[model samples]
Target: MVEQQQSDDNQKNSEPGVKNSIKKLKNKFVPGFQYTLIIATGFNISMLVIGCLNVHKCPVNKNIPLFLIATGAIGIISKFTTYVRTRFSKHIQVVYFETSLYSVESIFFFLGSYWVYKYYKPSYDPTDGDVYCNKTAYLLAFIYLTFLYSLLLVMIFGCCCAFCCLLCLGSGEDTSKAGCKYSLLVAAICNFAMLVIGCLNVHKCPVNEKIPLYLIATGAIGLVSKFVSYFRRRISAHVQVVFFETSLYSVEAAFFFLGTFWVYKEYKPSFDPDEKDYCNETAYMFAFVHLTIYYCFIVFVAFVCCCIVCVAICVSATADTGVKYTLIIAAALNISVLVVGCLNVHKCPVNKNIPLFLIAVGGIGLMSKFISYIRERLSELVTVAHLESSLYSAEVVFCFLGSYWVFKEYQPSYDPFDETKYCNKTAYLFAFSYLIIHYTIALAVLLACCCFTLCCMICTYKVRTCCQDMVSVEQENDTGIQYTLITAAIFNFAMLVVGSLNVHKCPVNKNIPLFLIAIGAIGLVSKFVSYIRDRLSKHVRVSYIESALYSVETIFFFLGTYWVYKEFKPSYNPLDRTKYCNKTAYLFAFIYLTVHYTILIAMIFGCCCFVCCAMWMAKAENSRSYDVESQPTNTEAREALTTNDESEAKP
Candidate 1:
């Protein structure tokens, strides 16, 4: 009996020890999971810095550095939001923000994966010519992707085991919790799998190129819609939001169905480096499975919708008028576009740009509709000024680059004998017209704004009575000007990317891109500093710093503008290319400089007008006060005027 008692005591002691160990493990795991993202973000920033510094030497794909910067920026922004929410606004939920950001990052990762892995084996030396990437950048990206997939597999296995255990041995509540977790895991896994397949590019098939773009656009729209819904509480209940989202998903589903058809039709077992139809068997099968899954999900959703409609009809329930009309309109438009694209898929054998044009048009229409919905239904709960500006900046850069590429590869007619010269005339014309219209409208608006500002200044000087009102107008206009400046800063970054790509090739002017990059970096940093200062304290003066940066930018703008103009040539002939500058880089640099010059002129005129008005008002107030004092004004009135003057001068 004594021996049994001793054994029981030992068992109880071991239980507490095991509990302590488990507690320690949980503590370590929790913090590790929390901080892993931050650590990865730091690594990403480091890679971006390194990539930028060695951009000229490395000649790495511009997309890689862009991806790094985008991911890093999102991570930093997320962390900032988390800090703000925790410290100042507990009412603000960050889950939606985080999820949207993660979705965007995942889309970027998919694109990056395609860019990096498509070259499976890239030359590290720049001298190896067009097919080279910086070794460090390439390996880091590869390893990060590999690690993510490995972690995903581990999570899948763990979730499966936990789910099985809960189903077999736990109570209903526990099983339900486990099931929720399992469903989330499954969704993540499926998303990752689809991304992997969509990014695979092993052949010259349009499906391979266009699938990624479709997936990216779908993800982007979804992220934006989620953001809108998150901020606008009423939007969550709105039928329009539901119809818009459903329409988007339906379009994606139909596109995926089309992709699956193409993939199956063009499947090949052998990989030939020289052949156009050289899809890897493994890659094709993976794409097939994922696309099939997507189509099946769409079918299932449609069936459910049909059943719901039937039940509603039986019960005499009525759908919202707006919802029904929106659904019909969206379905008609999306289906029409998809059917047209599918029918014309084979019309352009050499020019993939035709399909890109279709995709671009659809994307633009959807985005425009989404914007209209936001304008109509947006709540007053949150301001999306920065978000809108950021989107606009991205769109501007994308359109500009698309225009450049389209211009470069334009062919007037199809050539059966020469594959390089073959292009569908209709597609080329449509794309050209689309881009030209955009540029024409943009430039005209910019010129109109400049002319309006100039005219306003002239009128203000002539009519001194309106000086006070003009100053107030200018103050109100500050927000719009700030957005324009922000867009310019983003354009500067684009210029840097262009410069980096063309720097090595420009034998005559190697330092021009570098100079532009330096000035751009300085300008970007100045803007960031000004922003932080405004946020941290109202008393801090950033005008002097801003002035100095602007001065430098202006000086460089003139010098760079001169160099770009001097080096510009329209021809891309091999011999002429050696003598002239890269037309794309030079053209973008010129535009960047011109934008800065315009902003500088606007700022100068604005500041001058403000100062002149202030001086004129001060003189008038002095003259009026002197006259009042001469007339023997009461002491109380004089004291009141003195107090007002002091108050105005205090700042």
Candidate 2:
């Protein structure tokens, strides 16, 4: 009896342990899904690039590549959310973001499918003169969709088999419970049937319209019945509710079957663009794509329901190593950016600003990531400031500026006739849209910052009290100085990138941008090294080196600023490109010079104030010493009077 009791206690203790292990395993599945999704995004970006390269070929339908870019952008955001959730233990906001992305992506995928598959047999060769799409682009999209559908079917079949086995092993009560859930099965079946009817009658003019209306009514009634059953718990299990659900499903299924038969019997394709016939190719193609996706979604839902146990065991082994995966994703994205930019340059060499912008951003991003990796690996031996965020912030500013320019001066036209006059629409749109997304995000962040600042000002006392509790005064000062240096370094790096891109464009004073680039590079190195030295004083001693670098930077900045001002042109004439300097490059050079001068002036003003304060303190100290020396002491006066009295007595 004692041994039996001990065994029971052990089992009780192990139950919670088992439950916890299972919970952890379930939690890991989402990250695995995230990893898979990110990998898929890389493929999507590749397809977008291919489509962009062939944009001149598919002039009418830019939607394919546009959709790919849209999905890729959303995927990046989703990956970011996954990283944040994993890093911070934040769940609720991540869920909301994920759900929103999923819904938007679903709509985008359906529309893309409609557009891509509509031209079922488009000519592969450009010379064919038919509705042609690039063979590579078209095949990639087609294969992806085909594989997706096949996987859905397989998952659905596997789930059905699993469910049957479960039913066989289940007790009588379990079977009874399963029977009670027949309403759900009937609802799913009816939904599938409606989908088929919709697809069949999609191109049938009058009948197509009526079929959707019927489906909507059936869906509404089913939703209402389910809600009624849910709210009335006492009657949820009643015979009336079950009978009503069954009758509703049966009516919808029967109506859909009849519509399908009618459409199948009378179907005839109309090829004339202007004619209205029984079967419209356009409408049928659209409906067919949407309904097919809907069918896949149904199968997916059923698979999820039946394979919950399998999903629990589907946790990725690398889920815990999110940082490495994130780095990989970043690297892949940067490489794609570079490739796309290079392709754009190769296609249209007239406007190199936007392509070079892509190249610069991608290059800097990759460099920053490499530096971060090195810092992390050599964390014990060498200390490097976390400047990745600062670099990215600078990239955002440049992207916003570049996008503004693209929108104003270089917007591409979708007209096929204008292809020769403008850049490839696909490449131009990809760069423009990519930059615009970053621009919008940056704007939102700026607005949020402004709002938060306003709120802090209004609640200054509360903010101050909270900040005092969280951080020390010294820590606050250190953080401020550190960030200031980082900001300076980032600006210098930006100057280098912009200046190098524009250096070749200057006609007479080509050295202007080059000078700025050299000074900016020196200043950047100085600031970075100074920050490192300050942070790790024991390991690094570069005070004199930093001072010399800054001195040279100051001299070079003055010379560069003068050259830029002297050579600046206020107007740009695109037709006379040979005589005049590129206005865009000159403008950036001027901007960088002006900003650098402003910073230099501020620093000089601060140094003068420090000198004046120090001089005043010294003069005050000297005067106090002189006054003390000039004054007579009480003991000295008493001794002088005593001496006088003794002399008078002697006389």
| Top lDDT model | 2
Candidate 1, 1-651: lDDT as tens digits: 999999999999999999999899987875575476457656756755664554444344656655554455444444544443433355444443443344345545656666666566778877887777778777777777667656755754564565466458645456654565455445545555545444454333333554444443333333333333332332335323432332233334334434554565555534564555555454566666766676576557545544544555466445455854574465445445444444555556565645444553444333433332343234243343323333332333334435544665656456555655666565556556766766566446445544654575477555755555557665556557567666865876676577657755566676566556545654554555455344334655444334334434433543465466546654444466557566676667777766755764575456446546755896899999999778755887799999999999999
TM-score of every model versus the real structure: 0.45, 0.36
TM-score of candidate 2 against the unseen true structure: 0.36
After superposition of all CA atoms, the RMSD between model 2 and the true structure is 28.3
Error of 2 at 397 (Å): 30
Clashes per candidate (backbone, < 3 Å): 0, 0
- Residues 1-651, candidate 2: write the lDDT tens digits: 999999999999999999999889877875586568558656756765765566556643555555555555444444545544454454223443343344344435545565676566677777766566777767776776667656755754564565467557755555544565565556545545544454554435543444343343334334433333332332445323432333333333333333333333335645454655544554444434444454466457434533532342264343324654565576567667767876775454335466666665675555555545444444565433323333443343345345534654455554545645466666677777776665465446445534653564477656655774565866678679778987886777777777767765666665665675665666666676667666656866655344435434543654565467655564466455554566766777778767755764574456446546755886899999999989879999899999999999996
**What's the lDDT for residue 435 in model 1?**
67
Model 2: number of clashes?
0
Worst 10 residues of 2 by lDDT: 243-252
Best by TM-score: 1
The positional error of residue 571 in candidate 2, measured at the CA in angstroms, is: 17
Decoy 1 TM-score against native: 0.45
